[model samples]
Target: MRPARGSPDTRSGVRWGMRLTLNIDASPLRRWHLLLIERLETISGLDLSISLPETDLPDQSGLGPLFRVEGLLHNLRSDGLFARASRAEVTVATDRPMDESDLVLDLGDGRASVPGRRWTLHVDGDAGEGALVAALLAGRMPLVELKEGGALIAAGRPGTEYGRILLATLDDVLSRVVTLIVSAVSGGRLRVPTLPPTEAEQAAAVPQAGIAQTVVKAGFSKAIELVYRSCFHAPHWRVGWRRLDGPDLFALKRHPDSGWTDLPDDGTRFYADPFPILHEGKLTLFVEDFVHATGKGIISAVEFGPDGPLGAPEPVFEQPGHLSYPFVFARDGEVWMIPESCSAGRVDLFRATAFPGGWVKEATLIEGVTASDATLVERDGLWWLFATVRDGGGSFSDALHLWSAPDFRGPWTAHPRNPVLIDIASARPAGQMVIRDGELLRPVQDCRQGYGKALGIARVTRLDGEGFAQEVETIIEAGGPLWPGRRLHSLNSAGGFEFIDGSAMVRRNPLARRKPAAVLASS
Candidate 1:
């Protein structure tokens, strides 16, 4: 029995709901804080109010110059940029006085211990300090928590954008906090997070870059990106495949020593998000065929023989807007596909009238969501759909949301505790789920280095109506003797064939005069 929203414990006088006071620093609030307040107001049973700390918070206006310099260099817009809490635009419910029974949410740097039921934000075990900024400067996405005293209410590993580190990370952090509150109010139990432990050696512990240093770094990064784009199609991806004779990537936790055979691509386009399946007793591979000329992705398929692919992938499905991820499976004796169409603002179901062609839209699984890589699995007589949602303008690769339905197609219900996880390293679904040794294993994208920078096989500890939890057992990076690509994006296997995808540098103009390996590799 989940609570729809947060109320005091049953023993409290107000049984149905309780008053909520958001305690913040006395300094002027920033745009994000105001945005957060507005969001909370939309939820029922929150009975929201605000209280300011007695003491003024330290001024953080000094970061203004650095932000401006970095913004100009990267052409960063103000949409999601972070400034300071030193300025105010609007005021929220500061008129009301807090009652003894009111639940206090401490969102201040002072970390005042409040009476009664209280919630506080902590970053890397530091309560309400400049921990967020410290983690960002150290080039890490720190573990964040919403705690009541020493008890962990909810925790998340927020992702950051190196280009717009401050703004993006702030958005992600706030999104996680909001998720925690929503879960508590909705009668969902906020349990201790089961996220994988991080090694201390992985922490960079780098000092914050100064304004000049930030500007220089941004400029240098932009210069290299420009050169790379000029010379090749940026973010070009290629599919890799090898027959699965032994344990697959999930079991091995590393690429096979024999390595993967590259699926050749013409210079005009690239392939990614490989999904291989066996239909009609024949092996077929589907991919996101991204054409450089049109700058859009279409679902393409190719039949594979015992040795390798029979030929190049042919366009099997196309939509009004860009489509990819082509999640295909056999249901009710008919082959169906749900390709990623987040640009079209919907997750669609397609039926292949013909084996590999003649596709028709059967249904719309979900709509009005910017969700990526819709993965479906049946467990305990329920169909569960997993995808990372881009909520209120944040990174697309974080904030994992879940939906469950009795049937795979229609009438899906959003999970009450949505975004059950928010770790950049293991939130986004890389491919379909697999069961091994009576344990359910999921392939998740590790975006800590960057989007699709690596792949992780996570063991799902708990997944149900209450909440979700997973422990990442292995993180596989793309390099060394087997897979030499810079990014290991997705993983899938079927019909004794294992498939993966990764970043590849392709010449923008195939006919251009050949350049030395050193010159080409420098970009």
Candidate 2:
């Protein structure tokens, strides 16, 4: 439907959607630019048009007549500037010498000359194609296949690892861009939210001489580690636990490094994502069991007593696709589970027909999404679901999204400010959302260094139908006597027992190499 043509409504406080004319520099237009236009077409309440200049370098002085049109103007090229005295409202500005590899986008309320939001993107692919591919995929924006160097590459099909990384980088920027644009159009404040700091920013913030030496040392150390792993060592993860009481829940002190017990695992498999649940006065510990042979994970459980695990963990649930992060909870006297099913391309909810076994798929809360570590909580007479979603193809540890429903079952509505938070240091769900002293606190995975390097405790400052916000209160790292690892990912509690998981080092079995037939047959 066409938007009504008028000024913003002062009485109703609803800004009338205006016709947008894109004054783009068509000379360097690429596949990504075309994809952006396709996305813009899908947005309602905006009539869009495009105007291209005949000359390579269009005269900026002559753009005044073009700006005098009936609606708002989007000057996508920085060279074209409106006269200071002009009365038209221009909302966008692109920096000069724009290339596919680097772009600076500035956004502002149409009424202002100074832009309040700015994003600088350094494309990481060949000639900026990687960044463009990322933007197209992350937004789910479509584009026709384009030929390059005798090969046809589709918009969504990023064929290389570098391409995928580029896509993730672009996706991150695009997610923030959409947020800022939607907020501005809705007459909200033009303040930009915090996002993951760029690599350059992180480097510049550190001492250059020290950083250089550290980088060189780290590179050499990593090379040696890689060699050692290839010859004798293998990476492993193990679960750890400590008993807790009511008072311990509030002022929980870290157990001594020697006091924590390690969950047993076969040399061939590793255990992670520990979730403890108390059911009918019995405590059961659930975890993700990943086997090296299949390179996929399955859900496993072990009975936990006052001392420790009663026996070894047994398979509780297995799917054709990989599953991990067994987020289990009790509601209405029934047990429900929502494991990490990103590999299956959905957020599936399963109910136990009989205790831990006979688990059946009850419903799919979300489909066609790559979501991780879904956590749920009921508050304010509403049930809110939180998870970190991968937009197209990017880092799965950033971009937190929320959905709410009157009940845990059907008709879940997405939060208006979707992707409410996007920061690598604190966006991914790490564990169960808990209420401390009547205030809600969320456990987030801090992936700034790498996946699950630490845990962050964030307090939800504001949450409603209109918007969402949070403040990270504490960061828990993985370097103590009890739990010593390079990565600490999951945290959960039940039945006065708190569980966590972290990376561990394991030696490869020398006999495995000697018995090649046995290894192959077992696999």
The digit string of per-residue lDDT tens for model 1 on 182-262 reads 555444544433444333216445676765676566667768777878977776888889998998898898889899988
Query: Could you tally the backbone clashes for each prediction?
Result: 7, 3
List model 2 lDDT by residue over 1-523, tens digit each.
Answer: 4335465543222335544443343223322333344545555554444333344433322322322321122212222212121112222333222232111232211121222222222222222233333333232221212222234221111111121122233444444334333333333332212334433224333322332343344445556766766753344677877776444322443333344567876567788999888998999988999877688899999999998899978998999999999999999999999999897788989998887767998899988788989999999899999997776644676667889989887578887656665556667888898888888888777665556766667778777877677776666667656566666777788887887788876556645434321111000
Candidate 1 stretches greater than 4 Å from native: 1-17, 53-58, 79-81, 84-91, 97-101, 111-115, 160-165, 185-205, 510-523
Candidate 1's C-alpha lDDT?
Answer: 0.74
Query: Each model's TM-score?
Result: 0.89, 0.68
User: Could you say which candidate leads in lDDT?
Assistant: 1
Show the colliding residue pairs in model 2: 134-167, 257-481, 257-482
C-alpha local distance difference test of each model: 0.74, 0.58
Stretches of model 2 off by over 4 angstroms after superposition = 1-3, 7-35, 47-235, 245-259, 510-523
Location of the lowest summed lDDT over 10 successive residues in candidate 1: 514-523
